[model samples]
Target: MNKVKVLTVVLFIIAFIEVIAEYFRIIPLIYVFKPLISIVLMLLYWLSSTKKETLFFLTITTSLITNVLFIPNDLKFIFVGLIIFVFHRLINIYYILKVMKTKDFIPVVLASVPFLIVFFYIFFDTDLLTKEVYYIMIIHNSLISLLGGIALSHYIMNDSSRSSWLLICVLSFVTLHFIIFIEKFYIELQIFRPIAMSLNAFAYYAFYRFILIIERSNSN
Candidate 1:
């Protein structure tokens, strides 16, 4: 517990440092703190969760890789990162499937509509998305939408702190990607970069909390 508590604090500090680095354009700090985040969160999960979820750890690994790919700020690298992120979302969805009580298709579809709209509007906006990237976005955004929809469905059906955390965790990912889209594709919103990092940190914490809650819920 002490370890978990300390790591959680460390996570916050890391987020603060990374965001400040991003905002100030501190290259060294950005390089150092950015990668440290998932490492720390993976440790927190290892210490906190009673049942070690290999799937979750895999998610962390892929997320770390994806984040690293995104650090270059190159569109090509980011496109590859999106490919990896599709896998990350797949792992999350699979994990959620194992834990969630039921699957409601209607809720999933209804919940995903907004995200799909945003994705399509952006990808189809200009000459940015070529034939290949357009197809990739279709597959990628579909999975992302499915991931968010499932999380939202879980939250709606189960009114509890666990579900709430789950929803927050997923939305943090969604929002971070939304900003990434805006910054990378639409326009350069410099502020959104730090905001995305902060959301990433909070998402890690929320995911940790959600796991604990769901594990306890299952045990009960």
Candidate 2:
């Protein structure tokens, strides 16, 4: 009916087609649909709200760039795209810090440290990525840990539905990225690829919801 609802239906429909295409190994139209997810997601959020908050707009735009660049399946594009994503996370972390000033720093560090250690150890041990990309990964993942950790800390501190949804947004990205990492660097898994695509779409939706929650909070 409305723009957001229309895009909501359209987004999941695209996601469904992608999952089916990936699972069934349907090559036709796969590439076209693959990149449409981000475009529609960007539009969904852009049309829904937010022009006053400049940082949020920048985050959405950078996210678009990162997703589009990464879709090419080229190492150079992926590397550059990942670098841009680091900025995306940084913007996110900065935004979270502005709102979350609770005395939960210790908890955030505790929650993120173990995962960071494991991430560094496993990825560094492997020679899968080039030195540059590995360095970028280190920075990118550290920012991710901080972002996710901050979201987790905020959720724990407030125990509100908004914070819970925020955590879900973070988790979607973490989960999908892990699957992509395993699929890319480790072994080529078939089923998980489609699952990841579906989850990626959900991730965007969760993030859109999280943004809307924040928007409401800001206005109120």
TM-score on alpha carbons, each prediction: 0.92, 0.85
Model 2 — TM-score against the truth? 0.85
Report the C-alpha lDDT of model 2 over 1-220, residue by residue, as the tens digit.
3988988999899889988887876766566776777778777877887643666667767877776676557898998898888888888777666654445588888778766776667677778887888788778668777767777777777788678877887888777767777787888867987888777778667767777777777778
Q: Give the per-residue Cα lDDT of candidate 2 at 13.
A: 91
- The lDDT for every candidate, in the order shown, is 0.82, 0.76
Ten consecutive residues with minimal summed lDDT in candidate 1?
Answer: 96-105
For candidate 1, give the lDDT of residue 140: 76
Every model's Cα RMSD, please?
1.7, 2.6
Please identify model 1 stretches exceeding 4 Å from their true place.
Answer: none
lDDT of 1 at 103: 53
Distance from true location, Cα of 2 in model 2, Å:
3.1
